[model samples]
Target: MAKYNKVVLAYSGGLDTSIIIPWLKENYGCEVICVAGNVGQDAELDGLEERALKTGASKLYIEDIQDEFVNDFVFPTLKAGAKYENYLLGTSFARPPIAKRIVEIAKKEGADAICHGCTGKGNDQVRFELTIKALAPEMPIIAPWRTWELKSRDEEIDYAIAHDVPIKITRETNYSKDMNLWHLSHEGLDLEDPANEPQYAKEGFLEMGVAPEQAPDKPTYITLSFEKGIPVALDGEKMDGVTMIKTLNKLGGENGIGLLDIVENRLVGMKSRGVYETPGGTILYHAHEVLETICLDKMTQHYKQKLALEFADLVYNGQWYTPLREAMSAFVDKTQETVTGEVKLKLYKGNIINAGVTSPYTLYDEEVATFGEDEVYNQADSAGFINLFGLPIKVKALLDQKREQK
Candidate 1:
């Protein structure tokens, strides 16, 4: 008897997923429906419909969710200043919107189960499954990597070959990657060994941009305008969220602005190294941070910085649908109410230099901060303020002195 009547698989048309369609049909005797979410992976979608059908899939749904991804997922994380150990949480937050769309497709198709190609040892499996559980609590979830006969990518390649499944990579060229409008991440292969420096000059090693050494000699300066923490314009020209990010990606990529190499602690209790290229995101984060310096008060800024770490962890661990994340985002949105400003930056060979920043709601009073001649801030008044601020320290020192005399 068939285990499932129908199954909706989150398909990427990659090696693992290409083989999964046939695997599901052969093993479970189920009709496999593939869902590929388009979150800005450009060339990756080419001929995807044909590829899905050729691999024994009954149908394919390529959901265009780029606008939702950037505005709903990326911007909230950006406003929260959530960066997981220097990773902009690019792939971290991207999973929810994709998985949510998959769940919707599953419901629409009346599928018996939802399946994904995520491996058991990685964070992505947790991400996909968590979103599924949150959205469709009763829906059966299938993880092929956990129960399949294939143990490694090499074995998967063999399975693909035996099934005549077309694959885009070979043993020597396979580097696990995830790409969207926000960023591109490269892992596996040479990156598994932290000691090995990435072969950036090698063909296909870098797809988003060139290495920093190969960047243009002259610096590139660009201006960004923000309205309530959301970027609205580039170089004084109004733009939609998608267009602004796309424009920045080109400008930042040309200057080699955003390339990160880190061995970060994954949520699955292990450390893994990966290289990321987040050109537009890098510029946006920097510009927003600079704007906040003049807009947000010291206490709020310090407290938000502490909260940002927690926010980053939640996103990294795939807790996007939880109430805590929603609460934090609400708080972050409140903080951004006055974060309207413009910032100019100089991009020079992977370095982002702050040129200028301005905000109408800026709390900086030049008259109170000037060193030349400042009547607004009474110099003598600081003596009393400092005394009061250091009262606890002074009292502690006095008590220690009295004890020493005894």
Candidate 2:
């Protein structure tokens, strides 16, 4: 019931946001400023400004954040090797930065409140509000789905049609989606039924990429070079983060790679099925793993795997602002000190094969590891090492022999 003279909304020009602008204006009598963040959704952003204006938004702001999306958000999570229950945290990683930009725009525009089209039954509501609360504690968050009378996507469509909001969606193809440079996620519709097998070939609903079976027969080889855990080049061609993502996406998608379908547990106590397309991210995850194998010691690699699971959970649950996440980031960064290397991958029909990997600081010493004679490693030394390593086993065997005699 808080009064607001103006509100800035995180608008995507989708059906939900299209209706939200007029609803906010009519219900709260506040001027609405729509802000759209472009984090490599490609042509989905075309004509967004005019669309927002037609939907009754007084002002519209669209910002290009592709590089920042990859560098500040995606790479950090990638370096940490975070994945949410075997699925990469693609959509989860992009939310915090988008919400941060929403707060920044709200403050600049002198708005008392910020809004989003996220529903009450989703994780995005928590992600958006948490970012707002962390960045600007006093700024009020107006979540229409939680408070409004509008119930379903069908009702929202009706409202948009009645208001002449220029919506491109219809009831037949109603699947909630979120897209970024890393991945595209599809939810709702037939996917909600767990028994239903997802149709990846469907043109209008699923993201336009390749299916594994439909991918090219010939494998495409790619090499990713990294510096201090950040990807710096592709196949000896130096490129920025945005360009690197674009290049890899093309390579990975061509091979029909990076499609994930799962029933995920939402933070709001609901189980939802989502199909994700993360072509570039799939390549990066595999390439990074290949590099880590050469650079990280056995214990560091094992312990970092444990941290990655926790990090993924925190991000998925919208705990991006917590101290534990920062501490974990520090630990992840430390392990990446020698993660500088090139990982060669062979992409073929949805499989990313680790072709070759090399690092300047690699712990893999070929000379000492050779089965043949090597000056650095003496064969006789293995006898002493085996005795020390098997001390506990030897003691247990002796105790068992003594017990049998008793």
Candidate 3:
């Protein structure tokens, strides 16, 4: 008896997904429809349809969700300033939109169940399944890694070889990697051991950018314009969101601007070490932060900073579809109304330096802030303000002094 009449698998044509097409067919005895959401993993999609069909998929639907990804997922999170333990939530937020698209395709195809190649122990499983559950509550999810006998990547490779499923990676060079327009992450292999340093100089290890040491000696300056917290232009030229990111990626990568090495706590309750290259994303984050400093008021900015922490946790835990995330996004959107600005940055090796920033809504009053002869600010009023502010401290100290004297 077949468990499902048809299954829509979230296919990336990676090593795990390449073999899954055959595995699903063999085990479920059902037609497999593959859905590959294109969130700007450029060359990774090359010949993906052919590979999926060759491995026994009924058909492949490649959805181009890049613009939606940037506008909906990336920008919203950027506005929130969400960073999961300094990890820009690159892979975290990318999952929701991809999974949402998968659900759409599954409904369109009338597939009885949805499938994904995410492993049992990783965060991606939770991310994919959560989105699926949120969107289509009744639909079943087939996670082969949880049920199948293939215990390791080595076994998966062997299974791929035995099944004649074409895979791009070999055993010697098999590193678990996830790439998109925002970033490229490297894990597994030497990276699994926290004590071992990543081999950035290795020929195939880095795809997005060079090692910081390999970057040019000179600094590169560029201007970025933002409207309502979303990047709108690069180097004084108006550009679409996609073009702006791509251009920044090229420039940031060449200058070695964004390389992160961290041992992060995964949602599955285990610590994982990975090296992430997010040249363009890093640049954007820095520039946006610079713009907000002059634009946002002190209290609102401080409150948003606290909110950003919770926002990061939600995104990292695959709670993108939850009400809390939606509410926080609404709050973030409200804060971004005055975030329109231009930021000038100098990119040096593995560093982003703010050259200048300006906004029509800037609250920085030089007359009030200047140390020398500021006419706008009333210096005499600070005496009353300070006395009022320090009254609680003075009362507490007086009580303590009386207790000591007694």
Candidate 4:
């Protein structure tokens, strides 16, 4: 008597997911349908269909969501300047869209349950399950790490060998990873110790780019154009979403632009260390930030800064499908109406130096801002304006003086 007759599993051609297909069938007597979302993990998708079927899956649906990921998830978060604990929300924001598609495929196949490979100790389990709960409440969710007797990835590897399930990763090179168009994150292995500096070279784990020290000596300049707070062109060339990310990824990676090693607090109240590489995303966030300073007014920009922190916290904790995130996005989109502009930057080693920035919506007026002789700004106007602005302080000082005399 099977509990679930049909189950949809979020499948990557990786160790955990590869084993889960057979496990689901054996334990629950269910037909398994696997869904893989392609968010720009280039080489990770090879022979996925064959692999899924070989492992007992009835079918595999590989969805290409790179454009939607960038436009809907990446850009909006960028527009808000959202960075979780100073780390870009690469893996965090990525979970929602992928899970949304998983839910869609499950509905199409009339699946009785949804399953994922996220561990109980990690943040991704909460992310994946919360998305399922929001979009398809009736569908039951399965987490193997919560139920399976296997203790660690090493035990899982032994199980895989026993079951004749093929995997490229050996225990020696085993590092948990999540990759998408915006960023790639690495965890586990030697990274378990917070004191350990990542052995990126020995592990051969850097997929995005080189270390900053190994970068080329010379600097490279690039001109980026934005329309309505979205990047439209690079160095005077128009590009589509995926192509733009690919182009900037090459430039930023070669220049050693984006890499971070941090011990972060997870959604499930655990502390974990990981290495995150977000080459192009680092550039886009910085460039958009400078452009907004020129384009947006003082109050809007400062207020958005506060909201950006809140936005980052929400996305990092996997509340993407909630109304709060939707409301935050509304404010971000409205602020981006005049964020059209161009910015030129010099990329040298790990530094992104701002060369130039311009926008038709720029509020900067040379006549009003000049240090030299200017016709518009009257220097004498400061006296009356400062007095009026400081009237509260002046009154307080007088009252304090009278109290002191008494």
Number of the predicted model whose TM-score against the real structure is largest = 1
For 1-406, candidate 4 gives per-residue lDDT tens digits of: 3499999999998999999988898899999999999998888999999989988899999999998888888888998999988899999888989999999999999999999999889888888988999999988899998998898999999989988888889998898998888889999988999988886555367889888888899999999999999999999999987888889999999998998899888878888898998989999998999899899999999999999999999999889888999999999999999999999999998899999999999999988898999889888999999999999999999999999999
Give per-residue CA lDDT, model 2, range 1-406, as digits (tens): 7789999999888888989998998889999999998998888799999999887889898988877888888898999999987789877878888888988999999998999999899898988888888999999899999999889999999888888889877798788888788888988888889899888665554454688887888898888999978899999999999888887888887788899889988878878889998898888888898899889999999999999999999999888888999999999999999999898889999999878999999999999899988899778989999999999999999999999999
Cα lDDT of model 2 overall?
0.88
Q: Which lDDT value does model 3 have at 36?
A: 92
Error of 3 at 89 (Å): 1.1
Ranking according to TM-score, highest score first: 1, 3, 4, 2
User: Per-residue alpha-carbon lDDT of model 1 for 62-106, expressed as tens digits?
Assistant: 999999999999999999999999999989998999999999999
Minimal lDDT window, size 10, model 1 = 200-209
**Candidate 4 clashing pairs, residues 3+ apart or interchain:** none
Q: Pick the winner on lDDT between candidates 3 and 4.
A: 3
How far is each candidate from the true structure, as Cα RMSD in Å?
1.1, 1.8, 1.2, 1.6
The collision pairs in model 2 are none
lDDT of 4: 0.91
- How accurate locally, in lDDT, is each candidate? 0.93, 0.88, 0.92, 0.91
In candidate 4, stretches whose alpha carbon ends up further than 4 angstroms from where it belongs are: 200-203, 394-406
Candidate 1 is scored at a TM of 0.98
